[model samples]
Target: MPRRHLHVTGAAEAPLRAALRALRTELAVPDAFPLQVLVEAEHAAKAPRLPSYDATDLPLFTIDPPTSTDLDQAMHLSRRPGSGSASGAGPGGYRVRYAIADVAAFVTPGSALDAEAHRRVSTLYFPDGKVPLHPACLSEGAASLLPAHTCPAVLWTLDLDADGRTESVDVRRALVRSRAKLNYAGVQKEIDAGTAEEPLALLKEIGQLRERLEVERGGISLTIPEQEITEHADGETGGGTYELTYRAPLPADGWNAQISLLTGMAAADLMLAHGNGVLRTLPAAPDGAVGRLRRTAEALRIDWPHHVSYARLIRSLDPHDPRHAAFLQECTTLLRGAHYTPFRDGDLPTITTHSAVAAPYTHCTAPLRRLVDRYASEICLAAVAGTPTPDWVLAAFDTLPDEMTEGGRRAGRVERECVDLVEAALLRDRVGEVFEGFVVDVEDVEDVEDANEDQPVTGTVQLESPAVVGRVTGTPGTPLPLGERLRVRLTQSEPGAAKVRFVPVVPVDPVDPA
Candidate 1:
């Protein structure tokens, strides 16, 4: 649920892009695909392995950000023939057919492209651009599930009962085409206007039902507002300026996400049945964490009745509200412990479930971008086909977990650094200015040997405008007031160090040294 989408405009765009390029070098992740990998990808794009079964006429369509080129999934939704009766006939079910890009079909084991994917692990999306897992020739070309473009894929057919519970699943390699490529805003607009067709309307209906099912299953999904940078062009100066803002996610975003979650759950179920595969796991939150959150709600002055569960409480809050945003930010603590767990040959890990999902889950949805999904797809295929999981894939069980962990670490490093750099840049010119913000998180600096009991502690402050979150502290021996709006003066803004600091404003300015 932690998300950041970057945007650049004006003079800052060039400098930010340059800084990002430098940061990529510092992180040791190259900006372009390796020559050998690109060559292999190109060859694979033109003449590679293909699937036998074809389902191009299923009227499947893709939904993604308008700029997404390495499209990974396409789906077709429809009502199952019958289910409302005792004999199991009439409105009792829905069928969701999802198509995922078949990256494994093109990247042969031990090939240059395959090795490169293992090294990259996953696509690294930065503020300006992305370091893709595979070359464009493969990721954005032949293998991409572009609209009207047939591609090799793993097609998943999920049959769900009236309550949106998946009753059965079928998955296999197939050649499929996405009839149309749609964006969330457009589809949502149609839905809101009551002009949506069956496919689009069904997304809302089933997405809502699946959501209800999730709550019943005790799942948690944080609709964390996305922090984004936007640029506004200056007319007279012929330049642009940047502003960081928090954009609440649209309902369509969650609806589409539920479908992917459904697929991951199905994949996890398949692997567990066969006693093999990697699970996206998370240890359940400690019992006291909920107590802490209730306290957080109290601090933020939001009512939390004793009988209402955290999931329900979360759904009840409107993220656009500052107090609710602060609460949601606090809620991320419950899911911070998630990780990938792998096992094989009936050797299941002790923690087989993802706490946030409250269900067994795997990452099998986005094969084009994630290395693990390619492997998970292979496992799920073998599990369903009654064939042995590929030798290469089985062997990867040893290192894939570490590989994914390292990959995620690198991505996080880049993201944190990118934000630090941009936030510093945005505040550099106003280092001595004060901004209004609310404290969303607080961390107690341990009572050290020389420190006092009431020593000032650090906390995160969400700025009311420009939407930046930075460190804020109080005067010595005074912790920053939590969950309350206060004017914090920007005391330090060092772009080179990618650091920024703020402190509660003094009522009166100090005497000028000059």
Candidate 2:
């Protein structure tokens, strides 16, 4: 799904903030870092001398959202002559230099800062604000790879063949500076207008090449548009409300992601070869999963030819179509049981591959915002330098998996609940009105205790307007088929419970085959 942004105005703003605060309390998230941690951060920011190599002359730049402050990574991509090519100056391949914030360099192994970071695991973001994993003094200040400032970074230098395959990798700590701060929309505009320069200009060509390689490796990319809720206020009426909208990711986003993916793949290779590191792993989708999706496509009247690959078939669908939306939702069943696995001393990990990436992968970027990335970066640095891994990082491997898993579950619940609350608030005043929606998912009533007591079936419906998806009741006599478009009347909406319910208003007619 695409990213969702929520905006609320006037009267609705206060309540939404209050609700988010309560949700934070319910989730037991720390509102602020410990005082000792803040003091440590301040000291680290003030101290200048540290063990780092200087590479500040490189012209690097950062690309992210316009309002983003916790900048983590910067890049500089350029072409160079290949090893065996005829002309030394001719285009042989590409050299990519990616710099990531060196949070580990500032944080002592057993200090309060490290302990607090371990507890938080990752940053939890909300529409109004975010609960940061590290104090702002470092995450957004000294350790951040902001433009024009020399900062410590875990620099990754990768050499790729013309086809975008990795030829060599190097990881080191260096003092680097960014030339400019760029945003996705701005870079994309330049790309479309054919005026993009240097690194941004090379993104499209390299991104396409890497994407083709991904397909050849049997990797799947889900390009679903994300639905977002935002708030707005009216000065004339002295009123405020929330609005929902969809945000489709730009091509620049994919190009930037490929760089991150490339670095992670290199990190995985380093760790696996040395036999001591953590990996992000997922099992291959079961055989029966594809068969079930084919059946779903058949019932939805969508074509799924026997010869088509799953990845190709999904890429061919129009995301705006109701059938495609429902199909994409169903595809989630294939990607389950994703988790982190750790190995040591040349002991091969039982699960080494992330099925989604179709390659061995790990998390080594974004140390400013993620806990495991710090450890992963340290391990990679040691592996590349041919030195013994740090004892502290090795000791941390035993506990990080459980901490990260629990924190991830809590963060996911908070995000989903916040969206549900805002959606209910947006629809509360419109009860008893009919709207057009498509049945995205359905379930047979197992018992009478479900939401629809009298109706034999209950299901989820995605509305055309308001961009809301909620539960709806279907008549026992007329079953609601998946992907069927129908009219529904809003029956109830409770913002406090983050609940919404609807009932089918009329039967859906089958499409004519003229």
Candidate 3:
């Protein structure tokens, strides 16, 4: 790849320059309210305590991404094959327990820390860094499930069969001390090499069970590839490196599957027991997905099965090939918006369990990074301990949906803005340069029912194919189908707009379509 720098000598009257500077300043100091005072207030406020168990004896471990520090849950899975448990292939089967961190114990309700946590509500992931929900001193240290540090946790012991069905479950509050901290890549490598450690063996077994369950259920999802941008030393007078990376399925997805299954099972149990609670939600695939997918499949010349598993299809696609970019882009349309809302007396007729996990799920893994998890953990703690639920915790149940929904939106906006800024910056210096690109997606215009008669038209774009969407410019009136070859001229480049619109160039002697 040819390396080039995009300079930011803004045009004489570019409004973007001012906007970019203002955004830069905002990014400089992430808005984190002071939390120490709240921490003190929480400690001082008297509250009912749930009886604690000395589970520090049971060994636990946490596995996560390399850069993750706000550790939430931990696990230790053991098999009881001949111990009278079902073979685990059918319902009423028997499997050992999977434990998670009980965050509520450390963070008392109504504390300053709790208040600050509610305000932040979730973690903000910027390319440069993150704005943590809890202070590192606590999230990564005191409250974290770091090995050898005894911490209170909400533990779920699920009994399952060979087919990955949960027969029975037990939730409780226990004091735990993790045995080790493993990263996803390293553990995955170990699993791939067939050199399994004790923990990896258990993790593998649990992952297999979860995978089986997900495939059986109608949980459809896509394995979208993400690009990582780093400052390359020689690129811009010694800045960083920008590289596109993909995660292998094993241990990365496997590890996530284990945690998600654990959390989902726990969430389901809580919701079932309470008769009502706010659920983490995502709607089913959109209405036009099937037709759009058929068109995309035709564009790529890939067969679409009469019965399709979105996750299975995605697993078959290659992210390294630019050809797959457009396909993945096309898949984005199928994802419904994720939201949170409260439900009383099992009012939610249509449960919006996560589509990826194929089960009832909630945000309970990373309390230190998300506001909702803290309260959810508390609910689980109270229910498991059979203790009277705390007043503040109950109140959190009612308000968490609104806070979490808002937090999610904020996080998405911040992430998109950051990516736009960087991509725009990268393209600012490449104005007027021509590059070969692909036609990754295309859409048809449509009208919608409008309440206001003044404006009754709304046009939506659909993805044409599963290929890389690229910008081309030079000439007009040329047809560019998915997977078609094209060269384009870059007329205008606006980093702020993240805009690199191009016009298709036509050859002197064009081949007619058959």
Candidate 4:
């Protein structure tokens, strides 16, 4: 999925904030945790424990958005000689040390904090703010993997071969301190300028190697440019105005993601080996779906050779192209029916693989931001150490799927509605103006009240300017060609109702072949 952000200026912030609040109410998101939960959070902030290992000396660092405060995982990647006799006796390999915030340590089992977390399931984010699962005192303060702050963490040490294949895994609770807080753009700049320091210098090499391994394992990664709405002061009008642009992912972002992916795969392996734990599962795409996508590609004029895999073919696409963007949008049909599967008491999950990763995977990396990661981390730690899985975690395993699913759907609704509101607001004053756009999707509209009994055609169009996508009425006789560029005139835009509509403006000359 592509990332999105809405930056509203002071003038436009009030209405957007109100919409977000209304969305929270409509979604039934828990506004606040119970009083008892807050008390527990206060107490947990002061409690301390000694871990078996003090890894504060490790030159670990966190990379995230500049505004992020609830840091979850910090990492240090290096190449070193293998140790010991059984497994670590070879030449130097990659050593990946990932430190995940120990959220379980702060939220006690069967307590109000735990119960509230279960209710919330995951953090719900919006343009203005987020409704966090854990109290700020812990998630943003105590349990966060902040720089120069020694915090308890569930540390994962992965020993990988030269080709980035996992050779061994170790998980344990430890004390860690992040040396620095890094952001993607800055790190990418440093890397491009050849000024990247230790722990980040090897990121590209290791990340590319792991990417190769992923491709070899039949994994797929989509890299679509994200569309974001940013508000800025209008010099002429002296008021706030919004602008939309595409934000491409940096190389550092991909490299950092591989670290988290490595940890999740390791966590899944531990749980699956023990025949107990939660797995993020996605069935392989059906052959029919792939065939449909191939047809879509053909319609969009994208060459799909028989020799190339879908993953590789898609990766080769230029996201900036309208046809490529339409094809990528169509590819979403292939990645459907993802769900969490939990197994226990020697019972094996019928489905264990996450199709995107081409491996058994689970969530255990972002405990500070996600509720499931906390439970998954506890399960992985217990499974790796040959200790019994915590009773509370086991009890919640069966119900987590439902909770997470509901929360995910609600979050999706909130995101879509917010985007709709922004798009509507941006175009409300421009009704009847012509704009260039490409048809991305087509649909047939049936109206029984029509005396002529003729069905109307409608579809979605991605406008060239403003980067807005909205529904558009198509030509009556001719079906709108998907991925074809055209001129459209806005017919309706209601900011308060979060609605926008357009109508095709047929050209006087023949339409160019798409």
In terms of lDDT, which candidate is strongest? 1
After superposition, the stretches of candidate 4 with alpha carbons farther than 4 Å from their true spots are 9-13, 48-50, 82-91, 233-239, 444-453, 507-514
Cα-based TM-score, every candidate = 0.93, 0.92, 0.78, 0.92
**Could you say which candidate leads in TM-score?**
1
Q: How many backbone clashes does candidate 3 have?
A: 32
Kindly list the per-residue Cα lDDT of model 2 for residues 1-514, writing each as its tens digit.
1145554445534666667677788888888887899999999888734555889999999998786778889999888665533224336778899999888878988999889898888888766677888899888889888888888899999988777778899999899999999998899999999998867788887787788888889777676667767677667655557778755567788888888988998999999987899998989888877777787788677888898888888777776677886787678777777788889999887889999889999888788878889999999999999998899988988899898788778777767877777887789889999988878877734434544545657788888787898898777656776777778899998576547899888664532323
Write model 3 residue lDDT over 116-222, tens digit each, in one string: 77877776765545667766666676667888887666777776655455666677777778888888778777777788676566577666766656666755445
What does candidate 1 score in Cα RMSD to the true structure? 3.9
Please list the C-alpha lDDT of all candidates, in the order they appear: 0.84, 0.81, 0.57, 0.81
Per-residue lDDT over 1-514 for candidate 4, one digit per residue giving the tens place of the 0 to 100 score:
1157665554434555566577677778788878889999999988945477889999899998898889998989888655422344445578899999998778788888888988887777676677888999998999999998998999999988866778899999999999999999998998888999857987887888788888888887776667788667665554456677766667788888888888899999999887789999999999877887887787677999989999899778877788887787777677678898989987987888999899999988988767788889888888888988989889987789998888777777767877787787678789989988888877633323452324556788888898998998765556777767878889998655647898888741214646
TM-score, candidate number 2: 0.92
Candidate 1 stretches with Cα past 4 Å from truth are 9-13, 85-90, 233-239, 445-454, 507-514
**lDDT of model 1 at residue 243?**
89
Query: For residues 375-459, could you state the per-residue lDDT of candidate 1 as single tens digits?
Result: 9999999999988889999888888889999998898888888888788877877988988888887774542555675676678
